[model samples]
Target: MSIVISNPPYNMKWQHPFFAQSQSRFDLGLPPENNANFAFVLSALDHSEKATFILPNAVLYTSNKDEFIVKKNLVDKNYLEAVISLPGNMFESTSIPTCILVFNKRKSHSYTQVIDLKGKETKEIRDQRGQYGKTNTNRVYKKELNVLSNDVIKEVLSVIESRKNEVGFTKSVSINDIKEQEYDLNPGKYIDTESVDNIHRPYEDIIKDLNRIIESKNGVKITINEKMAKDLEIYDLMQDFKQSKELNKNMNEMLKAVNPNLKIKKEDIAALSRNKEMKFEVKNFERVPEMIALFISMWKQFVMTLNNEENRLLVELRDALLPDLISGDIDVSQNEYDAKEDK
Candidate 1:
């Protein structure tokens, strides 16, 4: 039997005309409009007796009805041999998480083996080399190249050859079990990863905690209001500092010191004064009072910007939190009840 291996585009969208003409190709079901991930798989299965295709992680457990049905048929027919969920950032071009779907046309076991290799051993490679062969870009390189590690290869081979369940890594699930899971071929669903904490909490209890968080948000609003008031007072003081007699005298002296041939007018200073926000456009002005006024204006602007951002964030927080509170979606008492039950 010939073996065919290909890494098709992750989520290529098929044109309507192609799907219209090639009806025989996708006998399982039509691939979803937004994604062509499964279409590539079907194309490979049609041409080859044994094929291994690299696909996006979404193809494993997509909730789409058409895709789900196709996946269900594949598992029910016992054509799907194994699914390996590889670690994220495995390719240099894209960080879309990927999986290997192994298919066999010949008679196979009733169970489909799934191996979750996510967060396994990772080797960092230089994605882009800089001048003098140094690593250039700020992007952290944690992706696996086309090559798989010897250890990972060995583990995969061991699981396939032995067909035994390995704790937290590999599992051979019956077709009935896969059907029970709504045909979710995601290996993580069946295999238990050692590092993952699968804590399933009730939604009601979580909503109650959100309610408590909403109540605490009131205190945050009060603190933000107080800070805003203080910021306004500081702004007023800085404005007064700009209009001081010392600053006006320094401005006049600096104007006199400049070339007399250069046109100087009171209206120029007046125009600059009209702007509430001060700018350091005054050239050749080294007077102590003028410099102090410039510094004060710049400092006031910075403080105002900081205060505005703080106020904006507070408003956004209130906007975000208040809706869930007012809607009564979060029940704080439920959390209290759950806590008591635990006791």
Candidate 2:
């Protein structure tokens, strides 16, 4: 045959590719054991002067050991005439991205033409996942699908015929240029795209935003969260502190009444309670030191726990801001740092 054209079953496995390694059809190399895509290409080319096949885009640049060797050999032999990349969702059964491979035994050009047709489609219907196709009226794929409009088809034919370079669409790449790309044939790999740079804001502004995240929410009044219930542990601790202090006061008065020169050491209390309804009496003045010792130890630990929580918040704030500041992403220059310190 002089010309052969086909769209074979994509990515299908074949046992013959593994066993028929000696066949001339695989003169380049055997296709990967997992898929018969390249096997179909080679077989079609064996019987004809020119063969064109629709295959999944993976054949263009897949790095599987066996398949890559075959691809490299194909490029080296200059069997490839042109590769045209088609958009994904072209098939009803699978949305696998596909491409057209045109191979010729008798060639006119040494360079291979690569065309990308991703953004050419003007009308496209998206599939609705997780919906029953028959039952759901809203399921788009059941009624319509993406297709190549006549204009897009004409555009592709023109690009192929012209074999001309169009920015972001097509290019005629030489074997040496393809080698520089390390045997990659994906059309997008050859397209040049615009780079977007990040805009860095003032460090203080970013810090304020980060602080809001760290805080989780705006602060509220203490009375809103405070419990009205009397049996709470905090209430008991407050009462114990108060009663002990009052008892100590009464005991001191009693001891001083016996002798004006007598005095005792006082334990300092940072947090105190005043309950006017409670009456004071000395049940056992001797036990007052032990009572103060126990309550003061508990109170000190409670204060320490609150302090530790504050320290943790400080650590977290530093962690959140430090990396961005150091990397110059937030731009906390020496001047900015000094200004923040003044603030």
Candidate 3:
């Protein structure tokens, strides 16, 4: 069977329906003149039994009336076989996201495979290449560009053929499900992470914590019993506990150094834990990334503060300068003003 693989120019604009009028490939009708994304798909399908093309996420469920019709027909006809979402910044010039859209004339399954590789910490292939290629005279700085490794290619192919659901990664979605979602083929729309209900700390750790709390409570009770066994008065028992155990010599001295009458309230508790659990929270979308997103969110706050302070400084400078420039106390020439502004 003939197969066509291409990555046509994204969202290219062409002459209106006039350019598409006589084109037999566009039996589904002309795509919007503003975007030739679907037009490229139609052209490939006409000449081949199957077509696999790279397209932007916008094509998945664009509200554009012309494109929606073509998108719907593709699902209805079962031309869509799989949609593999790749990480953003997959392209050099544009960080606009891209994904692999596979169309098949002979699909063995009733469902389309959906693979999501847009992970925050997922393993990626990258190559060091110059952003600007060799200029015979000046040097170019090479930056790491994400690329497709052979292993990743094979893994994707296997998953598409297998249709075995991998949690937070790949899912096999029915055509009916696609229709219900209005033919939206973005993997994220159909994929979900494991439920929070299923998440639990280790059973051994839980048991250990339970025992520790009980032991602490029991230790406090034993200490009270020892005091009572000595037949000491309740007030004396409390005083000794404070003087010997609760407050150290340094604490007593500090209290005396302040006002002798001043006191810090003390309590006898069955259990107390001074440890704090460290928490890390980021806006994670199912299997999507977190650290980079966390950094971006933190940096945004700094940017906002810097801009606000800059505006305040400018206003203050303007307010300070008006009287100085007008009173002739500080002679300011036009060149001096321009030079100061430049600096």
Which candidate leads the pack in lDDT?
Answer: 2
Specify the poorest-scoring 10-residue window by lDDT in model 2: 217-226
- Model 2, span 212-231: residue lDDT tens: 22221111101111132133
Give the TM-scores of the predictions, in the order they appear. Answer: 0.51, 0.52, 0.53
Q: What are the per-residue Cα lDDT tens digits for candidate 3 across 117-224?
A: 854323344443332222434434433345666777888899888987888888999999998888878787788778753244332333233333222222222123
Best by TM-score: 3
Sorted by lDDT (best first), the order is 2, 3, 1
2 or 3: which has the higher lDDT? 2
Error of 1 at 208 (Å): 29
Encode model 1's per-residue lDDT on 170-287: one tens digit a residue: 9988888888887877786788545533333232333333332222211111111323434444434334323432332332233232222221111111112222443333332212
Candidate 3: misplaced stretches above 4 Å? 17-22, 120-137, 197-343
- For model 3 the local lDDT of residue 343 reads 21
Q: Report clash pairs, candidate 1.
A: 208-331
Instruction: Show model 2 residue runs off by greater than 4 Å.
Output: 17-19, 124-144, 193-343
Write down the lDDT that model 2 would get: 0.57
